[model samples]
Target: MTASDARRPVQLEIAVQDAAGARIAFEAGADRVELCQALAETGGLTPSAGAVEAVLAVAGRAERLAVLVRPRPGGYVYDADEIAVVAADVREVVRRGAGAVVVGALDAAGGIDTEALSRWIDAAAGAEVVFHRAIDTLSAPVDAIDQLVALGIRRVLTSGGATRSIDGLGTVEALVRGSAGRVQIMPGGGVRVEDVPAFVSSGADAVHLSARRSSGDTAPSGPGGGASGFDVTDGAIVAAARAALDEATSGS
Candidate 1:
């Protein structure tokens, strides 16, 4: 571990889909909120301008807001026209008051699409940038992390190229050691409240989780099954995760 890792405070970043979930996450002690839409359908699609505005309205002074800039749901790879769309979305989110933006892209070679990523970062207008989990799709995540750092990305949300952080703890640890404070390695993907302490102990500077639970209500049959009743952020789960992180960091 680097000397700085000993002093870095652990952060909890929550993913929320709408104004209601954003408010819940903030109130429950989330340090940052990743705002997106269609999380249930799309892994997380770019929220509308109005949704971004609403989330910003509810964000606390100390809370950081990051909007997801994915133009589509199928893949991280995008063409020139799609890159243009992502650039425009970055501008819109920053102008609407997001403090950061989460984005990612891949080349046909299954590597970081530096050209596309650069354009999105440029369009952020100085907002903090986070390379999203698409990094997991790369053949070499450790190398990709270095490239992202060279690009001035502040953080990268990943699960160590696995389906879950816990399943890839070794890779996550290597990333932490490899980073040596150059970039923040945030463990995400199926990170549960029970997993916070282990993630903290594993050298994650911060952790990202949705803390989501289904509403348990079924919608009538319709297009896309009438929206699947949507999953919302669970404030209690967020609170528990925060407490766990505090305990782990304090003890360390």
Candidate 2:
């Protein structure tokens, strides 16, 4: 960051929906926490106003908290009812004083829904707006960049529409370049400490991950239908992510 990059050390935000998870991201040195209810479902809107307040009350300044604003989980394209629901969710989330709101919408053709996005952005007037990974789902990555830039999104959290960020290097690289300085191109999903450099090299301002590998005692508490493949984000994973950023900074 050079101590003057505006946002230093390449912010490492973690996804934590519960208090226990909040503590993990906070103690492990995550810069921001994207609060949600169903982490396994790629997260939805914040569970409650009280939930957002609780996290802010105890989380550190480095640990900013944000709430997701999806009415329900499905494809990026939302029906009119879902859009209204998400708009309402945005207003509520902002009133609760979240650091940011993560939301996205796609057209029927899998492109950025500028109209729906504007509604979400308008409802979240004071909050930072993150165009969630729905961007990766777009039919055209380059075109999506233009749409997001035109919409003045605060950040675009994408994995290049691939299962993981690393796998979409080429698309991600193009996005970073096309975006230039219009919006922050944040490569997330399956982002690991080891691959942090590539993302940075691809010009990402930040990275996202659950940052947990094992659930430990929380193992039985799974979030999937099969009851297996639980997503476990832990302190160690966050620590490793931090280390990766350090290495990248040192240019090692």
Candidate 3:
């Protein structure tokens, strides 16, 4: 087989905050799901042990599941105590049947915290490890990519230092080229249906998205115009993304 032909097929990974969302994403053809909590507020937090078990129970045999291991949100930098919490959470999720754990940690200088990250990686217990979007916050992403590859990270999810992958296409493409197949660069953040083909064309081996939509389950307004209920994953959106990825890869 040709070198390119022998490469693994592109994949679509959906980030879902709960079991209901997990079911929708899976049924709609998601190849993998990153299970987490408080997506609206924290981007994503480490899901409870029970939550991880419940999502895995409903996943299909073909669908892989990864759990985010952030103890809390806000930032990727963590103190020693926080690092301990992250390590504990990673072990808990793996024990609960997660096939992989999504994690990242930055030092005070805004670079990959290799020391802190090592603890979580060791806690993964042989499961796949994906460095999360904290890569985007790095002062030098290319340099960080080298570090992660050396550390044996399977993939790095990033928007190429932009708020959206489409806006960062050039950087993402550069990252793909720079990795030289040593690591997979998965573009994420505000990925839309129309953007999938472009991302695939840019050499992203995989893509991540939330596929979230308003479920019309609003909460009562408390005080002054506060945030409403959680947005659920839309099966239609997930299906469309899957179809888009299929079309992109098939046409290539």
Q: Please give each candidate's TM-score.
A: 0.93, 0.87, 0.93
Q: Estimate candidate 3's RMSD in Å.
A: 2.6
Worst ten in a row by lDDT for model 1? 1-10
Candidate 3: segments with Cα more than 4 A from true spot = 1-8, 61-63, 221-226
Clashes of 2: 3
Rank by lDDT, highest first.
Answer: 1, 3, 2
Clashing pairs in 3: none
- lDDT for 159 in candidate 1 is 89
Q: Pick by lDDT: which candidate is best?
A: 1
lDDT, model 3, position 71: 84
CA deviation > 4 Å runs, candidate 2: 1-8, 41-45, 60-63, 214-232
lDDT: which is higher, 1 or 3? Answer: 1
Where's the lowest-lDDT run of ten residues in candidate 2? Answer: 1-10
| lDDT tens digits, residue span 87-133, model 2 | 99888877867768888888887667889989988898767888888
Model 2 steric clash pairs: 212-232, 212-233, 212-234
lDDT tens per residue, model 3, 123-212: 887888899889888766877778898887988889988988889888888889889899988999999999988888888899899999
Better of 1 and 2 by lDDT: 1
